[model samples]
Target: MELKGIHHVSAITANAAGNFEFYTKTLGMRLIKKTVNQDDVSVYHLFYGDDIGTPGTELTFFELPRAARTHEGNNSISEISLRTASDAALEYWKKRFQEENVEHGEIEIRYNRKALPFRDFEGQRLVLISEENENGESGTPWKKSPVPAEFSILGLGPVYLTVPDLEPTHKVLTDLLGFRREGSYLSKNYGQSEIVVYASGKGGPGTEIHLEERKDLQRERLGRGGVHHVAFRTADQAELQEWIKKIENTNFINSGLVDRYYFKSLYFREPNGILFELATDGPGFTADEDLSQLGESLALPPFLEQRRSEIEGKLKPLETKVKEQ
Candidate 1:
């Protein structure tokens, strides 16, 4: 099946409010949705991204207050990439970070792309880079964000996954999902070997997937600040359905046709234990709210209407405003 690009990335966070502030006020993403975790309805499942929170632009978080601080080892998400338009946008971001007193490392080149590495409120590594893509499409303008329309993120970059073995996981990405081997590298700090894979496209942050080799680290526990899943986008519902058939033909169990409010999703696990999802891009976050006021309040899927009050009550309130001293 032909794929369009990434759909969204879901990560866990210890403090929902803090994560919301960092992504919206600091990183300049629009808080596009406020909802509850489907499985664990007690916590808030907040989403941040471009206006209307288009498929590829979404970065979701699950709030868990009592989860332990996870050590950054080889088996966790090393980093996530976000794409920018040009070198000028990169420079603008550099200056913006400086003015905000957000510590960031020097701009550097990796795999021939320029990237700026930094941490979020919970130390989850993130990078913003200017990688040109020929077929890449720009996201909807979020007028409320401080970032100008010209500099809004195109989409989520490939999520980095650290695994003990590469061959098995690589098989799932390439053989099953049609990703090609782009390059490989070694990291001194984490003492891990790495491989980079690219989907067929003009390569950019969201297009390149990185796999790290950490043969000795223990498996990760899913909690706050952990990644829940990485979703890839298909051209349309027909294309997504074809992928569902392909997955079933391969003898892998898949959660078929689950309605995720905005998009229909199919969920399954790759070989390395990372949850992978295939999601459709139509009827997006804007379906509920006006494009202007998305992410401004709590939005629920129609099926969950009866439980809205209970869900809201269980979630800790989240706000984008800075706290008064």
Candidate 2:
């Protein structure tokens, strides 16, 4: 089966209130879901995206009130890139970052695409890449977003993961996951070894995954502001099930079939141990809530209905409004 693109990338944050304000007010993404982690109901699982939380545009977080700071190292998702509508849009973000005094890197070129590396308040590594994609379309902007729709973020671009060795992960990507090896690029950003890129599906801006070699770095210490897993998109349930069947028979381990309420998911790990998930595209953010009322209230899956009151009472109220100190 053909993978469409990235489904969603999940990460962690120690501060729920801070994370909610950063992504919504500072970044202008719409909070499409307000729910608790199904496995751990005391903490929150927040979903942010374009107007209605489109699949490709999703960036989710699990609020960990006291998780340690994430240690940057090999075998972890290093950076996540988001698609910018145009070079003009990139400039808008630069000015906004400066005005807000947000920590950001200077604009640089990688793989012929212009990118600005930046970090959230929690120091989650992120980048905005400005490239010309004629086939790409910007997602619907939040009605109350400060950034205009023309300059709104389109969706997820390529994701970067640092691995100790390339050959093993490369084999899993190309041979097993059906990714096509594109060319490699070298820059001072990485060291002597060049970063290899593997393209999935039709391979547009949001369909690329870059693997960087960083053997000297230490193993990632899982905690707040670190990516939990990267998910690739399957068109629907049938294709997702096909992947589950393929993974179960392989040397790689898998989570089998899972019902995530919004989508069907099968989780597994690449050889390097960076968590990977295959998620379907159907029954999306609108499954339970309507477009107009999206993210207004807490949403619970069927299994968690009985404990809604308990969960809601435990979760801190996540206010999107930015309060001046």
Candidate 3:
């Protein structure tokens, strides 16, 4: 049994309203779920993806109001990558970012794939990579997105991790998690450091992890715009249980079998202290809301339904009305 590609990446956002506007309006990703953070009922946990919130396509953010900016450094999930359909799409986004005044870099080749690095309003580091010759799961684009379907963000690409030492992290990824070392590339930012490539299920942009060993920087002070965790995809609850057993068998302590309501999960920190989650792909966002009206209103899991009134009272209203093109 092996993990699928990336399940989702959950990051932190300071302003829910601005996050909503940027992701849904500027980036053209559909806000698939409008919900509260289950652990802390007061804050919002917003989910964005393709037309429907597909497993690999999901990008979530936990709103931490008035949080400090991320102190960028090593031992962190450095950058998140979004997949587009082609090199032509890269050109489209380049022009689009210029027109929208979005902070971005010129299109460049990353591990042989054309990539355009950009930042969100929160200074969240994200790169758009062309999936021209890439394989694995390609997420469906929202038909109604302001960005044309041909050039819209498809799904997650390789997640980049910055660590001081790669040995322990490499062991955890290879021996524990079954990711194989594919190859390496010279670091774009740090010329002295080499970025290693590891692929899990089916080797491709979606299934890969680009690890950079950066001993030069301090440990990241995670805050707003920082990635909380990156979850790799598993098949279902049964498969997730097997993974839990495997994780428990190892020396690493883990959050065993967390029932996330939408999908079951197992959370554990790798050797470098970066949070890694193993999550199921089924019982998705559709479990609570209809496909047509997802993210249109506040959604509560069945377990949290009784506290809806209390939850709603705590959250500051951020309009999530569905606007079709």
Using lDDT as the measure, which candidate wins? 3
Question: Per-residue lDDT tens digits of candidate 2, residues 1-325?
Answer: 8887788899999998898888887888878888888779999899888887777899999999989999988899988998887777888899999999999988878788888889999889999998664365456777777678777777788899899988989988888889999877875575657888888887876888899888789998988879999999998998888898889889887889999989999988888999999999879989888887777788898889898888889988876442222
Model 2 alpha-carbon miss at residue 54, Å: 1.7
Rank order (by TM-score, best first): 3, 2, 1
Task: Report the C-alpha displacement of residue 285, candidate 2, in angstroms.
Answer: 0.7
> Per-residue lDDT for 1-325 in model 1, tens only?
6566677888878888788777877777878877777778888778888766776788888888887765655555667888787767788888888988776877876666677887776767778877554346656656677677687766687678888887877888888888777777555346544555566444445655788778888887666556778888876778878888899988677898788878888999776778889888877878887776666678888888899888878776766432222
Best by TM-score: 3
TM-score of each: 0.89, 0.96, 0.99
| Residue-by-residue lDDT tens digits, candidate 3, 1-325 | 9998899999999999999999988989999999999899999999999998888999999999978999999899999999999999999999999999999999998899899999999899999999898766788888778889999998899999999998999999999999999999886667757899999897789888999888789999999999999999999989889999899998888999888898999999998999999999989999988999889899999999999999999999999986656
**Candidate 1 deviates by what RMSD?**
3.0
**Distance from true location, Cα of 114 in model 2, Å:** 0.8
The C-alpha local distance difference test score for the whole of candidate 3 amounts to: 0.92
Residue pairs clashing in model 2 are none
Error in Å for residue 235 of model 3? 0.4
Worst 10 residues of 2 by lDDT: 316-325
Better by TM-score, candidate 3 or 2: 3
